[model samples]
Target: VDIEVVQETGSTNADLMSRLPLLQRPVLRVAVHQTAGRGRAGRPWLTVPGGMLTFSLAWHLPQAPQNLLGLPLAIGVALAECLNTLNQNVQLKWPNDILRDGKKLAGILLESAAASEGGTWIVAGIGLNLQVSDELEAQVGRALADAPWLAQMDRNLLLAQLLNALASALQQFAGHGFSAFLPRWNALHAYANQSVHILDHGQILHAGIALGVDLLGCLVLQTEQGQVNVLAGDVSLRPA
Candidate 1:
């Protein structure tokens, strides 16, 4: 599967990991409309051209699976199993952010490149906001009109069922990694038990409830003064 339907891109995973080693094909897809996209604090992925569903994908991971280190939590369990097939309350927030009823919509950005003589080459980008025009959610300053639980959806059958459930969850995560996707990523977790705000490296780590994600993907809160994993982070679901 090698697709490419572009119009603009400042980051389809950095223009497909800079052309994936002159590509010969190991499954490369690239659907874009707009994305000067960026996230994980650098934040900028509002991406509105035709309203959203930007994309990117490159492949290859022959033996890479050291506990999976949460490759964006397995692309947020492949976009929450493709927004649970459009019934969509879309969960999944840790490490990748996609939420629907809770507001945000979609996002997944995994990048890796360094194979000049080294190794590694990933690209997996995505951005789905299907259609939320309050003038693009106020130019994405954020406040989807008080989230009315994401008022029903359609968007071309939810982007062809979210690219066929993210190509069957990236072919079962490049063939069985992340423990075959941590029990459907703790069943589409969205702030797993609740209290949050990890942010790290500027120190704001106070947590209690979010226990899911540790085979290296880090983030496993549960604190009343106890469990706290986190590794290169961000948590933020606080406000109870």
Candidate 2:
């Protein structure tokens, strides 16, 4: 994999997407500052120079997988698993949010584009809070978790470990879809067996206990109507 270190970029995901036509192998873009970073549901990603570490990795496959929706969840599992060993407090929020001590620590965004060379290209963008600064918390208007360990650690070694974990997960996903990661994802679920609410556009859709996820990687909620499988989209999950 080729690594491109940039002091700043408008958006690493967009940068890698534009380079997909010329892509032949995996590529990783590390941006110290993203002037126009974006999160899931088109939310603006707030960042401060030296206070956060943001990067996006691009991988190409000959074809798209059957369970494409599960890709982000699988990545979440991989991230939580990788960080859990170093910091037991690391947890995974459904879909693709990485939490620490019950607070948001990192967000993952996965975007895919068709390659001109006849394949599929995926760019996984990650934004992680490196320091719990008052300014950052104020900008987000929410409590956030910081990875002080990551702040003090060598970035190169940290990147190597994260990338390796991602590589292994992606390789496994390519072979088995999401069934292989369902159990792992549930094991690290931040809201496992907890009362949760499924919402769409701020309207409650279902209120129930999170029963982890099914084999197909859909969120299984134990509601009064019995088990309900929720698909990922603009839907949001929160504590009830």
Task: Kindly list the per-residue Cα lDDT of model 1 for residues 11-121, writing each as its tens digit.
Answer: 677777778777656554545466577865566776556656677777766556554456768778876775666456677777777776677777787776655534566
Q: Worst ten-residue run, lDDT, model 1?
A: 144-153
- Give the clashing pairs for model 1: none
Top candidate by TM-score: 2
State in Å the error of residue 105, model 1. 8.0
lDDT of each: 0.66, 0.87
Which window of 10 residues has the lowest lDDT sum in candidate 2?
112-121
lDDT of 2 by residue, 127-220 (tens): 8888777887898888999988888888877777888898899999999899889888888889999999988999998899998987666789
What ranges in model 2 sit over 4 Å off? none
